[model samples]
Target: MQINRLFEMVYLLLNKKSITARELAERFEVSTRTIYRDLDILSSAGIPIYTSQGKGGGISLMDNFILNKSVFSEEEKNEILYALQSLSIAQSPESEKVLAKLNGFFDHKRSNWIEADLTPWGSGKDSQSSFSKLKEAILNRRVICFEYFNAMGESRGRTVEPLKLTFKVYAWYLQGYCRTRNAYRTFKIARMSDIVLTEEHFEEREIQGGLTMEDDETSLLSLRLNVTADSAFRVFDDFSETDIQRMDDGSFSISVKLPESNWLIGYLLSYGDSMTVMEPKHIRERLREQAEQIAARYQ
Candidate 1:
């Protein structure tokens, strides 16, 4: 925790361009003496920190001076390492480089905290290869071709412009423009049929500040899915939490901005009897036909 606070001080000083010991102590809830002590530590560690006694000057890092990773405490090293390891999987070169730079800061014991190999998704099905190619596409700002299996067990080949990588609800997804559907779409790597990193390039998009998707042609489809209480959480966690409206009898009315594709059909089917199509009579009808066919198979 002390190291974290120290790193916070350095980050703020470098960010603010200038601040007084009084400000640092106040912001960090420490005594002015402690602030001065921190400055001394930075200065000794070659952070180029110094004090000025004149009007409006207190403490500052030199304009060109930089943090030497060698001076980072074990805890600071641990944080940096963890961040870098995550980037490596998300395909962030900057994060991976930070992980490499983190190497300069940590001793052997601290290096253990930066394990990039372990993943929350488990090791079996969607491990290294899936994330590896995704990171590659993101780093290069390129579109990639991948085979995707729709809900009907149909596999389609398509290309997508990888836009941003996201971590939510304990999974990783690539949100991008789906070329075939001509819409913005989010694809989960775990469900990806096969991926082939293409030579085609794409201009990178800015990190959208929040979950709001701009109403655009790429974000075109909207649908209503009627789901029981047990199945609602997955939908809530997938789409905007605000998008879900509750019905009177404890069922759910789920609305989502979906790309135009057969993918929607498969998604609804994944819920099986736990959900039903309410709007877009076409989807509801289609589900009915499929159910009848499946029943006929049993008969």
Candidate 2:
């Protein structure tokens, strides 16, 4: 906290040309004696800070002082600003303040190079609220409770010690220790609801590694599909360019390995008649049966 105060103090003096020790003390909620001590520390650290007792004289940095430009190269300064700019996506006010100060201190204008939004398309405010709450719980090392829905569509109440928030495979997931199951589990954010940040605090656990998506390679099925030209946009959207082969007729052939599951069948059905399963006879059969069931319901 003192380091933060010291850094902000330097920025303030740099911007205002002169500020009273009383002003710095009030700004940082410290005593004037503490502010004087900080001034000493800054001076000892090779900062050109001095104070004059006369009227209109307070704490000031030498007029020639610019945060030693040689300490960070031009590119390094831009990179630092860009990194802080990215944190703006989370709407962190502290980061925004620090970013502004650093921008002025470095005397560099940051360009709008990138934009990121974590909320998915069509998602309402609840999604953003849940993300913010989970982030808070993680930072404070507090337990969280929520209703979670699994792939089978079963809903259950869960009390978890949230460890990390991750984004992978086009979705956000919370990796946490599930008190209900007594083990570590990853819960999809969209499948979570009624989240409550519990008062219970937790100690940091020795997590082995980052979130891992475990799949049995031996059980995976190599899927190949012939997508008509009408679904060309989707083909490129969902599959990598290396996996897609453009056909002479403008249609595309794609090959990928995926686990055979009801979810896979449902995904194929989403393409409707625009896609045909060219291999794996069992998947094709499964798709046909699913289609027939839908038709029966309509009839």
Candidate 3:
């Protein structure tokens, strides 16, 4: 912005021969030292300014000094205009305020900032209370209270230290410290309800585990399961793309080591009508036992 102000001062001086630093300092509300430095930078870039030594002394540019195509190439000028135009169309709040300036600058160049805007919520829409509230908590470093419905649909109220806002492949998740669970937990934003910012502030904690911004091979849940082809996609949906793999038999299998958890058994049980276990006998037995309990309930 200071560069823009400097250009404006030089442009105004083009209409006249010279202007004193005192006049510039008064108009710009900056010290005369700053004005002198600005003048040095401008003159070094071939603006052709020199000081006069008299009672009515001031700064003057040579009569033949013309601002032609010496500063920037036509391509470079268009490049700058094109970049500013792109920024004017960004998904931020500042784009609309810049439209007027882009319009004026358009006539000064062959490039134009097109029908672009920066409304993050799109046309005739606004951000939801969930986004607004979560953003507020994150900004203020405050704890939040909300009801979390886990993958099992079990609802629980919690006062957690908000750690990070994560955007998983298909959903937004809040990774935080769960005081109840005594561990870090990830809650899907869509499944969260009645999210409120609490007065209690939270200390910053590093998110030690779960998905990261990078697509590293070691960053995904790499589990090997012997499942039917029908359930392969469903299993892959939980893990990221860099980790999913298909075996030669077209079955639900992974390329890396798997975890031994009850959730794994439940995951296999969902496809009761099709899945089978080959190497993991324990998981298969648990799934069979769970299926029998369901059958007993029906009976």
lDDT of 1 by residue, 15-58 (tens): 77678878888887989998888777777866777778889887
Screening candidate 3 with a backbone cut-off below 3 angstroms (N, C-alpha, C), the clashing residue pairs are none
Show the colliding residue pairs in model 2: none
If scored against the real structure, what TM-score would every candidate get?
A: 0.48, 0.72, 0.46
- Clashing residue pairs, candidate 1? 91-135, 151-266, 184-218
What is the lDDT of every predicted structure here?
Answer: 0.70, 0.84, 0.65
Per-prediction CA RMSD (Å): 12.8, 5.0, 9.2
Better of 2 and 3 by lDDT: 2
* Positional deviation of residue 69's Cα in model 3 after best superposition, in angstroms: 15
Task: Tell how far residue 7 is off in model 3, in angstroms.
Answer: 17
Give the candidate number with the greatest lDDT: 2
lDDT tens string, model 2, 107-214?
878677778777889988988888889989998899999997655456789999999888876788888888877777778888889999989999997555554332
Q: Count the backbone clashes (under 3 Å) in each candidate.
A: 3, 0, 0
Candidate 1 runs further than 4 Å off: 1-70, 73-75, 87-108, 111-127, 133-220
Candidate numbers sorted by TM-score from highest down: 2, 1, 3
Give candidate 1's whole-model lDDT: 0.70
Candidate number of the best TM-score: 2
Q: Supply candidate 3's per-residue lDDT for 34.
A: 92
